[model samples]
Target: MGYNNLCEIGEERIRRAGEKIKSEIEAENAQLTLDSTPKKVPDIGFRVLRVDDSNYEDRRKNVGSYSQADLDFDVDITKSDRSNLDLLFEALPKFQLPYDVRINTLSGDEFDGHTVYSVDDGRLLACFEADIPESLVRAMAAFSPRPSYALVSEHSLPDSAARTNFVEIFKQSADSKTGSTKPYII
Candidate 1:
């Protein structure tokens, strides 16, 4: 087959796989539902932003303090498929993306705490929570220039032997043009 034909086939396979996983997740969970489907398929992708203490210092001294940003993404799944989504999330570590990553759902919250390890290729993974606030979701979707994915991280030094690093990576996106200079404190 031609390259385009092969590519189309591959995409079809991926779509079928996603559909199958969605079905399985629905079968396992009873509360999940497809609240809204995107009118058009998004350009699904990922981005990574790195913030080391040295970089922060350089930016602060020259470019001002780095701004705090939030990342957002959407998954087409019903409440019933939450379990399957969790399973898929757990399976991401095995893909060998140059990082050992874990996303654990914190108690009393709807989503999980994303923990990244051994990051060599600047990739992190996590699952989405159903109860994300609409305003926050809208804000996250409104990043200027709208990246398919976004990564925000910061570095700090506070009289410690080692510098502190706070990083967040996102897998969904939209177009918002507001900018701020708030620092992420994690």
Candidate 2:
């Protein structure tokens, strides 16, 4: 009953159930009312499951060792083609989120122009944007309802300084909380 497994299975079941109900309604030839369906429906964030390559890039080398200069060069950890949704699905199971957990995308100005995934109503929040900033990190940490777990891509930050700031922001945010437990960062 890991979170990832549950989210996927639950969503599929829901879709199947919806299809079944729709077909049944169609079979009965029920009169349709304009008010029956709303004009606006939220994005449920469902995708067809398929076999794909790993989200991260394979950097393994057979060489016994590398020089300091060689290691100094930057490397992209994630594959270029992977999307936010891809990362989310890969992370869901690892975090052990519930099957019926709710997921919401927080974006626009409120989230500092970042698309953040709020899982189970802030129990876990994840941002996979490539260009993350201190303001965005702070916003996520200070997000209302206080996420117990926060995930950010290491490659999102601009530099080593930003990376250091990312950890410090979360640390400071956790220190301000009432309990001894701090939110887990990934």
Clashes of each: 11, 3
Model 1 TM-score (2 dp): 0.20
Over 1-186, each residue of candidate 1 has an lDDT whose tens digit, in order, gives: 544766567766767776766666655565545784324333333223232222111111233533332111111212333342333333343444322233322222221223212122223222233333333323333433332332222111121121122111122231134232121221
* TM-score on alpha carbons, each prediction: 0.20, 0.68
Best by lDDT: 2
**Candidate 1: which stretches are off by over 4 Å?**
1-99, 102-127, 138-186
In terms of lDDT, the poorest run of 10 residues in model 2 is 177-186
Q: Global lDDT of each model?
A: 0.31, 0.72
* Model 1 weakest lDDT span, ten residues long: 159-168
